[model samples]
Target: MDLSMDPAYSITKSECVELCAGIRGEPYSVSVLKEGYCTAQSDGTFRADGTISLITGPRAVLVDTGGPWDRELLLSKLKEKDLTPAGVSVVVGTHGHSDHIGNLNLFPGATLIVGCDVSEGDRYLPNQLAEGQPYLIDDHVSVIPTPGHTGRDVSVLVKGTSAGTVLVAGDLFECCADEDSWRDLSENPELQEVGRQKALMDADVIIPGHGRLFRVHRTPLN
Candidate 1:
């Protein structure tokens, strides 16, 4: 079904703030190990950093490892939670961007899902994300293809959280207040717009790829 066509709800963006404070819920507590940032240089260059998040639930899931520069910081954050690299059962990279999956080497035992591909070690597990199916990690966690930022981008959706449903949306949204800027960064603005609309309709809160956690305000379509 085309979720974008659902006419029951209207999605709107509001409230962008750094998640220096994490959100906790039953079975899953989300912690932002690092908040992503994008900066334009004086020259014609740009610097970008990816956000790193840890999802503690029935299974330990680490989302977006950040770039190589974040290796030590990643390790330190895990240690603060009394978790070791091996303790993470799954590692998800919303897309294959270097800034997002750079530290994947740290978790050799993890089940890796970068974009729509799922794998364990050298063996790849098949899934239907490309065909628009959501992969369920469990009843409360799912990896859904959000595409457009990249041809195969995906986002992790966690339900039953303290803040209601949280979509760890990668660049599916560059930031909460991205209405004016996302098109410039998107690979397929049209498709991404559909996905974004669906996301806003479904999530109560969103963890954007490069900023903070924001609330999704929904207005019922009569």
Candidate 2:
């Protein structure tokens, strides 16, 4: 798939700083770290987004670690931020895709919170359904289940600084294309709609798996 077609394919202008994207929500700071990708399978190449490095004040986490092919470059990104692999407190993959989990093992000391394997931690989230929230982080950073891109896929939703709500979506949009590529890129297209609805509803700014950060513009569904 030629990802250049999407409006979000351009490189983000800002680095790690607070710039308002006009989302009506809480505050959080961010650094693009790497532009995400459109994962396509063919000839032993995993074309997908690079690691999405996010800073939510309380947590220094990476939603997806890009692909193993670019592991060193991803590490250098952390270096540029003065953060070593051990410094990152948490690493969460949106799903089990190689592009997202390529650098998981590098952060062995960090808590692994992804899919059903997410470790049990004492963190409370104040949100719509506050009773017995299972995820490790607080409502400040809520984890939403988004299966379909991969059956165990999940998206990390956190209130941002100026951008409002930010989601480190795994392969949620596979680089933020039209709904056509959205469904076409999924492992199970039939099951993706449910996840899609949840993503659109929960996030205002999506740090898509393989694309630049894009504001979530909601519209009525057919």
lDDT of each: 0.87, 0.62
Q: Single out the weakest 10-residue window by summed lDDT for candidate 1.
A: 1-10
| 1-222 per-residue lDDT for model 2 (tens digits) | 222223433322222223322223344456667776555577866555554656646667666777787689878988987888888887787777676777777887777776645642444224322232335466577667677776767777777456667777767666555447677667787666765655565556676666656665544434
Clashes of each: 0, 10
Q: Against the hidden reference, what TM-scores do the models get? A: 0.93, 0.73
Tens digit of per-residue lDDT, candidate 1, span 114-180: 9999999999999999999999999988999998988999999998888889898888888777765
Best by lDDT: 1
Error of 1 at 109 (Å): 0.2
Compared with the true structure, model 1 gives a TM-score of 0.93
